[model samples]
Target: MILICKPGSPVDSAKKEIRLVEIEPSSEFDAEICSRFCFVSLDHDPLPRYTALSYAWETALTTEQIKVNGAALAVTPNLGRALRYLRKSDTTVAYWIDAVSINQDDGEEKLQQIRLMANIYRCAQTVCIWLGEPSESSPLGMSLIGGRAIEGEPHELLCGQALTTEYAVECAQALKEILSRPWWSRLWAAQEFALGSASVFMCGRQWFDSTQLIKDGTLNMIVSILSIRGVPAESLMLLKYVGSISLTQTTAIKRLWDLMPSQKPSGRAEIFCEILDQCTTKLCSDDRDRVFGLLGLSPESLALSIDATYDNSMTEVFESLTINLLRHLDSLLVLFTAGVGHPGDVEYRSGVRVRLEDPYLPSWVRDLRRPRLEWMFPPWYGKYRTPFNAFASKEWTYRYANNQLMLKGLRIGNIPAVGLGTVCQSHFYRPGEQADGRRVLQSWMALCDVAGRERGRDPYPHGGFKADAFCRTLYGDFKTTIIMSGRGDFNSVRLQASDVDAIVQSADWAEKLAQYSDEEGEQEAFSIPPFIIGRRLFVTDTGYFGNGGAWIEPNDQIFIIMGCHYSVILRPTNSLQSCTTYRLVEICYVHGIMDGELFDGVPFTGKSEDESTEAYLERTEQLGDHVIEPVCLC
Candidate 1:
């Protein structure tokens, strides 16, 4: 039906006004849901009190009707249920629900409302999260989250209390069911939860305080149950099973919790990038919402220029975002998210390849709409540890022309030989079925051997043993481990030669390989490095061993661009012009030049302590026979 605008106080676009729904009191919960719209100016003093709703717009085709201002309005069954449950018996309630407050059919109004979303949620007296009607296990889930004391021994409890095996299993299963619900996976829910001043989670008649979940250690308790030591083998296995199913949701919740006003970063750019990285796995119906949904959580300085209109094409939206990132951030770390290639370029399993529904977007732009199989660098390297600086301290100079990204860099060498790329079968296969990974590693080793023999040298061009370089390149020169200090905690340290030798020469290599996959819960002491899951090994003409994207071929050229953390592979396009036009293959990890070795006139180690900055630059320009010029990528 139609939502009537106020007689004289229609939405004042200039005053940052919004509409809120007033749900009339009803004694019967099942009675016809009646609501009316009222306008409120956020800029006005003594702001109106209302609760904002955060929920998943269910994808079911079926819908239910509700009366708004005496006119029928269509709504999803999920929303209808939420409205019915939220209705009070005697007192009327106010809500700033997106489905009813904003007219979805009006693009301009939608854009305006989106721009005010942050304030809307931030100003709300409370934010109520609807997790759908309760199931049989919901009471147990709500009880655990509500911090109800569990009956357990001191030793069996997560920190000190002793938990019976049966009780732990019950709690794990209950938490799994709750976390697996659709609400946790929606991208918009994160912004709503993070921006709300106060939030309460409701499931049918059960409710829990979000603050209590943290202050009482209920969330941490659930996490510890999944990973705590000394638990029975059967109970541990069941917990691992639960973790395997709900790891993504748990991670999302933890990330959102960290973004709450208390812990969120102060810088605009930091908040924007953090949200983008953390919410990569979240889902939204419209691809544009990949950026729009998170805008409300970002600082105004970073999001002010990013328009939230639906008229722009997906390619345009992503291109604008990439340009904005380049203009704001100092490093080219954003390029790492560009991903491997378009769909069908790299197969993730035996018969499955990564899918990109919109393949027409520019190559340099990250397609956040699809699931990325692998990133150029591991999370531990970029997040917990200092990233590589392949180009030293050179400042980047770039410009966009004809839809191509042009930047200045030095071409290092061309890939002369390539090994079989690893296919990511971790999600498709279970433990003890990782033969494909072992076979691919064996193939890479053989390729390295052939290259060494052809060069007829015991030492690589970087003055290190060929075997050492190969080993280092396999794991991206770093080792990652899940530290037990907290949930999902990762720590990375540079790999030592002895550690590599011990792993390669171990008698249980095959068993360890079988146990290794990219899955989160299955990581072990000797697990395979997750960084190389969907990458290939390549040897350059200069005898540099590298781990590159799965799309690398024999003739792809390597370049170290200014401000980029790692070397990048570029493939020449079929342009006959004198100036070369190329496509960005992927960011790569080369053993010798990762620490500015190429830029400092050194082969293996970085610039000597005695050399001055000017001396280093002068020597680098002449020693390596390198030339700095503009490189174009379309």
Candidate 2:
């Protein structure tokens, strides 16, 4: 008998009927064997505790068939292998495998199964993870891991003492063999692993302690083993795929995340952010799974009714995530880490680099569908990247309606001048004459000279005067770094006046460059060519000069947009109804004005004596209402 759950119609619920397949155990695999099945109503009968199968859906191996109630049921080669291993000669096992248990043709049933996925796994006595047929090294690997499972204290082998050369070599092979499985990278696998109460990893006919392998010190042991010398190059190559599942999935395993094992517990927002950041590289068939997969693990996921619905479009799902994130979190800090590079082919610094030309997405929103660009570094030689958290709470407000993002912000000034772009070929040079600090100092001086000449307000008429003012404009603080000289408030630079050195004699500059070299590495010629080429020196209307992106044009508007952590550049378009519209040009990296520390109360009296930002705003108001409005990005 083969019990088939009828296709879910409009009037029927997912829980109305149940399909059951009674799998007969056999000694070995038989291609043409038939099995019996029955249908039971969940409302009338008490369901039996069964094992749930968790495995990756391999597309190439999907044509294989297995017998069910005298009929051929198509399945993946991996599933067929799993079924063969689970079968016995005399006994029949009651198992809940999603592929056979759920009606795949019915969209309603599929959605319902996804909703009940957490409970289904939790109800199972054991979760069997099929990692396909084992390799030649599988037995050795299992034995090595199994050996560590001593009386009550299994991981003592790993934590006891430093591994010997012999042990390291052996563990290296074992680790390479174990991590090479495809199960670790799947998004659904992550959720399945977390929801299961007890797990059993099945490979061929052999079984191992799945709990110990994932939660225990197996990864650490493998890392240690690989670190030892004399490991083969091929073995080392295999270790590259050995990545851990997200912390969220691990949290779901315990059914509680009040306190992470190694991490200090924070609020739900913090946890969600961490999970999203860490698991950006995890693979999923559907783009929506990128957001939906983590909902089961996140404690605050209930706030947004983001259920597993197949009806929602990709854009709609993305919109839902963005809107909900904004509602839950006060700041739009995530936008700062969004996908960005040069306009055409935005390359990543690490991982698999693929160019994305998504004109549909707004510049403010991150393309969650793309591969994680979290590894991409900013264009600075030795700059330490820190999260933007400058403003106090309630400083910014945002709303998303009619597919438009609205925000309250302030206008800073227009970009008047920029620096030379990286026109030369990308270089792969050492920390020699190419990375000379004197050259950078010269470029700064040149920018200051050009801007001063254009403005007709030359602050530095002499040699050292130019260098000193340029330094002050960049790194000088208000109260301390800038001192009131006889002429005006002059920012000071501690430059070394060496008698032998000619071009910008300063050991301090070299020392600064050296600090960056240590953090980022010496060979960075290929990394920041865009930053190098487009290193435009931007001079604001108020005479504030600093280095901005090459994309920053002469007329580009630099704004301190509220809710955004970094300063954004926008190009003014056609005027509409007394308001000037703007298009997103590019996000810039202006050295001094990034945190708005210099934008606040800093005096700019170069144009007029004692005229502050307040005075400029007052004058503008007297002229006419110049409303700084946000353009609705489609």
Candidate 3:
């Protein structure tokens, strides 16, 4: 029998002993291997449903809103289906499978395919990330990975370096040769992240070596693909392997954040909140100009946005005021739903307990019988709340903790994410419509605590509320939760270690920061100065938003206040009257600039205020080019 392989080979003499068969795309071939002692048997058929289902999703997904697109991605977890959907929309979509399709009949074919895999994907327009499972049930969460792997590579800028991109060495000789050069290696692939079972790394052309910049032809090839491809080979493919980074990488990530352009905003209004969600941390206000200056806004510019009559130090006056107004709207609606015929019952609150079973929890969370415990539950709590005494007694007025034990009940999960409140006393009772003069002042502060020189304070509305929770001074922000264990008033509250730790540590930058001191006698360039909280500065601004409205413009200027942003209907609260416009009260500090200039940027507006809220949001989203992220390659 004669055996044949595909074109391109080097065998001048040619070996007569081995025979090969070249197989076509659709025909059946022999599976038995006679030359060897074993003859493998095969029995299987094509999975048409898998392929057919995939085709439909890929075909119709582009114009349709992804959130509304079939729940197949959420329920089925089949990447092939998503690919099929994309295929329908983009006909140029070509399926890239090296193993079975290319006839892996021998080692030659295998090597050729391996060599071409990188190029094939690199050349494609869109790349689909197959992170989730094909079945409804898969380890998407566990598989979710972030950050590039850290390495001890000799870094030029920071002492240590973190990997954020990737390089391919085995496939192309030119690629391998380039990576072999110490200077070339450090120039491009020095800090990179490697992802996927195949260890592929997607990269871009533009690379800045801390201070110097250079371009590589090889790297340019990868960058060209990112810029030119109408879409990537894989539109939304998630790799199995996660990249990591070193201490240097961590610092670089923070600095690189400002340099990295924001993604073009999609239809989702909430997308804008993520930038500040983590908050503009990592540095003090002084350094804001030097590092974050690239962005449109500077600290002084942002501070200038102060509505003359509004508090100047309001951390985020616009967002603060907007969210407060929305909260008032929610409160009014709540009172109306309660059928309380009066204007005295309308008011919203900060940190409300999320209901799990009021048909509010998503099918996945409820079906899995798991709350997001990581956000709220401490590790010591374990699978059950046996160690938590808060739920031990039944008559505790705030006995709602015990009610969380039931599966269907609205139970806070062990995982606690940001934005979710840690406060608990307001769980059972509904607040009255009228302000009970029971509002808490809030502010975010940054501090530096040396052995004997550390202090604390709060920063809020015009920085004068002198609030008890957040203490602001020249130092950083710090917090303390004053809880009433037994029946008592605010003065009667006792602070617990766990409770107090939560507050102090909530805004604590201790772990992420180091102490620094600067003076004229101090040597050349020095680190940032440390802040010590002097006294609790509080803002009496009644319009600070809690967590309602947040918007980020591609221009980099952003707004974040809390309350219903996307939903037009306001939530119900204790309300006494029906007014066309609502008002909110809060304490905060607003400071930031647009593009390093000392001017407060105005929110984009249209015909009506409601229309302006969305118009400004739309304008912000329209700023950036929807560039695709590079895949990780090894």
Best by TM-score: 1
**Judged by lDDT against the true structure, how good is candidate 2?**
0.52
* Model 3: per-residue Cα lDDT over 219-313, one tens digit each: 33433332233323332111100011122222233333333235222211121122222122212222221112111111222223323222232
Ranking by lDDT: 1, 2, 3
lDDT of 3 at 526: 21
Cα lDDT, all candidates: 0.65, 0.52, 0.21
- Pairs with backbone N, CA or C atoms under 3 Å apart (clashes), candidate 1: 153-161, 153-162, 154-160, 154-161, 154-162, 156-162, 156-163, 157-161, 157-162, 157-163
Clash statistics: count for each candidate: 10, 10, 131
Off by over 4 Å in 3: 1-195, 202-538, 541-634
Model 1 weakest lDDT span, ten residues long: 482-491
Which ranges in model 1 have alpha carbons more than 4 Å from their true place?
1-9, 149-173, 214-271, 342-358, 375-379, 382-385, 418-446, 449-457, 475-528, 601-623
For candidate 3, the 10 contiguous residues with the lowest summed lDDT are: 405-414
Query: Per the 3 Å backbone cut-off, how many clashing residue pairs does candidate 3 have?
Result: 131
Q: What is the C-alpha RMSD of each candidate to the true structure, in Å?
A: 7.2, 10.1, 25.6
lDDT per residue, candidate 1, 53-161, as tens digits?
A: 9988988899889988777778899999899988853677778999888887777788888988888998999999888899988887766655543553212344545
**Which candidate, 1 or 3, has the higher TM-score?**
1
Alpha-carbon error at 83 in model 3, in Å?
20
